[model samples]
Target: MEEAPKTLAHQIGGIQNDALRFGLHGVKSDLVGSHPLDVAHRSTIKTHEDMKRKVLANTYGSAFPLKMDLDRQILTRFQRPPGPIPSSMLGLEALNGSLDDFGFEDYLNDPRESEVYRPQDMHHGMEVRLGISKGPVCPSFV
Candidate 1:
């Protein structure tokens, strides 16, 4: 490829930092005209230098530790549901201090009002019952 004649333009910003551009050219800076604007540029140059140092520190200085982290494996245990509380632990429980003993002598709370049907109370299974529908039982058609 043939290269064209290059023209230098005064950059408004201090320095251009691009990987591709830095790769192609060494480093680009446009503090041209050797009049030495030292007083005006001293702060700007210091700021740029500080930024460059910070970037270099972050990029090169702060690298992954050379020591292999092979021992950095974290071992996590599998949690399981706890077993049933023992008889001794029952009394120690905060919610229910002690369990009540349940018993049924007659089994029925009141035999007089019991709903169980006896032989004398039987209706001879004469109650009319509806058959199951084969089609949809939607109420919209009805």
Candidate 2:
């Protein structure tokens, strides 16, 4: 039995001139235009010079950073909510007096009445007797 070739050779055929396959023209152009020999270096130098000018202007001229008095400015620009009218101010006192007339103080002081008003028994009975279809049980019942 004969042994097969160990190295693989890719064949690029159909070109009339084999010399055209070497890419000599592209390689020559790349060498000539490589970084140190091209317009890229000149452009970088010009950009650095422009940056230096901007830095000098900001440091020595009227282009300094801004300082603002935020509290004074915001206070001057802000609008306050309208003040309460005299009738509304008097209404608060009348409401407080009415609570006193309603015996709210006596109710608050009674120990028997101190228990939270809960209707849990009513809620459980509704759930057992009426089922879920009847709307939400009153929050007072919960």
Candidate 3:
């Protein structure tokens, strides 16, 4: 008689089976809906990058790692439902201005916000003060 193959789950007392089930649940959760800004991938990287820089320039260079409210506006524009691109979002001039100035204006301040502006770190002397000067620049991978 031929013996049946044992699953890793059986050998490990069902832990592997539990882990696989957990992973499948996570995948199912992802399929339930598209996440905000996921539609941005349909746009070219050049479009996104230009949009990001335009955003930063208008915010006087303070908008990188965008805040929640700004994130929502970008999401809404990219996910516009089955229609022509909005007139306000349609030209070279639009790219030169902030979204707030162009009619998609809901500038809600996020309840959780942090300042991202920092002066350039021109000196290497701080490395010694932080006790990291002696650390390996790249640790040996092996």
Enumerate clash totals for all models, in the order shown.
0, 0, 0
Select the stronger candidate by TM-score from 1 and 3.
1
Which prediction has more favorable lDDT, 1 or 3? 3
Ranking by lDDT: 2, 3, 1
Q: Which ten residues in a row have the lowest lDDT in candidate 3?
A: 133-142
Score residue 120 of candidate 2 by CA lDDT.
Answer: 30
Structural similarity to truth (TM-score) of each candidate: 0.18, 0.19, 0.17
Residues 1-103 of candidate 1: C-alpha lDDT, one tens digit per residue: 9887696654322233322222222322343443467766787977875776577567767442221122122111222222222123432232222235343
Q: How well does candidate 2 score on lDDT at residue 137?
A: 32
Model 3: residue 77 alpha-carbon error in angstroms: 30
Candidate 1 weakest ten by summed lDDT: 121-130
| Pairs of residues clashing in candidate 1 | none
Between candidates 1 and 2, name the one with more favorable lDDT.
2
Q: Tens digits of per-residue lDDT for model 3 on 1-142?
A: 9988775322221232243222222455456776557766656666986787677667765555355446557644542222222223443335444533534233665222325322222222234234434221111100
Per TM-score, the best of the predicted structures is 2
Model 2, span 18-85: residue lDDT tens: 33322222345545645664677788877985776577568876342121223334434443222211
